[model samples]
Target: MAGTDKQQDMLAEGPAIILVEPQLGENIGMVARAMANFGLGELRLVSPRDGWPNEKARAAASRADHVIDAAVMFDDTAGAIADLNFVYATTARPRDNFKPVRGPVEAAGELRTRFAAGQKTGILFGRERWGLTNEEVALADEIVTFPVNPAFASLNIAQAVLLMSYEWMKTGDQAVRPVESRPEPAAKQHVESLVAYLDRVLDERGYFRTEAKKPKMIENLRTLVTRPGFTVEELAVLRGVLTSLEKFSPRKPRGSGAPDAG
Candidate 1:
């Protein structure tokens, strides 16, 4: 499903669960069920091999309606996590990349600290068969691995999600973290709308004429827009600017009477 509905119906202010290239709908459903079992709400899917809105996933989710209903899909790992300030990659094997490695309990503790400090956090789970690639793990700020028996390090996607979910729930509400008095960050949907609007305007002006460069340009725009915790007022102001630009004089040219060229 689209992410707009998920943004509106966000349940708990817990860390997001991002599934990258999940293979089976049943696994997706089970992951959602696990997240719901512990109060985790946001679930993001990055390029699931089997498309979304899967009946198998829904049936597997069973009574965990909230998690399944609010699940959102993305095209890539970077886009899936663009809105999150902090992310943890969950894996079983060791990689050559240089990153802070933490066990589940330690990572959970760190997540709590970050949450208390008002940061959007997420946990990245790789595919069911081979797990996360170095490139995907590199995207995360830290690597989270379980202390499993070396002989059998493979962990099911759903099982890994449940363990992290359980730890996230373990941090009791009593944790005294200062709540920010400022306005809550604008929802991802609203931010996306603003970006899309700007993109449309740019497109009409032939700003993306170079077909080969358009993707990178768009990526840069999205990154620039979503990196900040923009407030509602800020978003409104930006959209207003775009609207004004769109209506700006297209007839008059500079000193010479040359019509505005595309």
Candidate 2:
């Protein structure tokens, strides 16, 4: 099964991810995957080089089909964000414009605040190479940039989307599911019983070789067994393993045993 829960509806209502003249279908698909990772689902494309409904994008998106299937295409940058009340244009290079600039984190927080106020917001991402032109940046209400190495600051189209998507999600309150199911903790009696059984077996095997060290060794053994606070199921498995080891015995080689008789 896919990592997503089909039972729950996708979060398709956050700020739009607008890509201007995106070049690759794979990058578009990957951008969808990244958006899905963080719960933002709206995707807007402006004049994609390979055109819309690209199969290469679908394959690259992994199982994030909802984002790809719901993507909206536009003829130009202006049309892509026409309905949005606020928009942010992302750029790596410093522009000569006077618009307010924000880092990814601050932009995400602002998006959350604006969204709460019932304002529609969107972020504009430029081409895979060269990014948004100065005129395109002017269309946005504010500029958002990344704090990257000044010497080399260019980012992949999908990578830029992922960073912004992640920041947007981080600003929201979402619960993370636990990795594994946890059973009830073992009862105190169950823990003591296992410890007692192991102590008996070890004593029989002469594991506590010296009387002076025996008490400390037993104490250490008890501590080790009790430290983990094993679940009920785990305790049962341990007891079963101990029982099997106690009953096991090595058999003599068949040929050696029957050599004299032969």
TM-score of each: 0.65, 0.63
Give the runs in model 2 whose Cα sits over 4 Å from its true position.
1-9, 174-262
Top candidate (TM-score): 1
**C-alpha RMSD of each candidate structure in angstroms:** 9.2, 25.7
Q: Candidate 1, residues 80-171: lDDT per residue as tens digits?
A: 88777677889886665556789998898778877777778899999898888766776666789998889977789999999998888788
Clashing pairs in 1: none
lDDT of each: 0.77, 0.77
What value does the lDDT take at residue 7 in candidate 2?
14
Model 1 TM-score on a 0 to 1 scale: 0.65
Tens-place lDDT per residue, model 2, 137-161, is 7666678999999898889999999
Candidate 1 lowest-lDDT run of ten? 253-262
Find the number of clashing residue pairs for candidate 2.
0
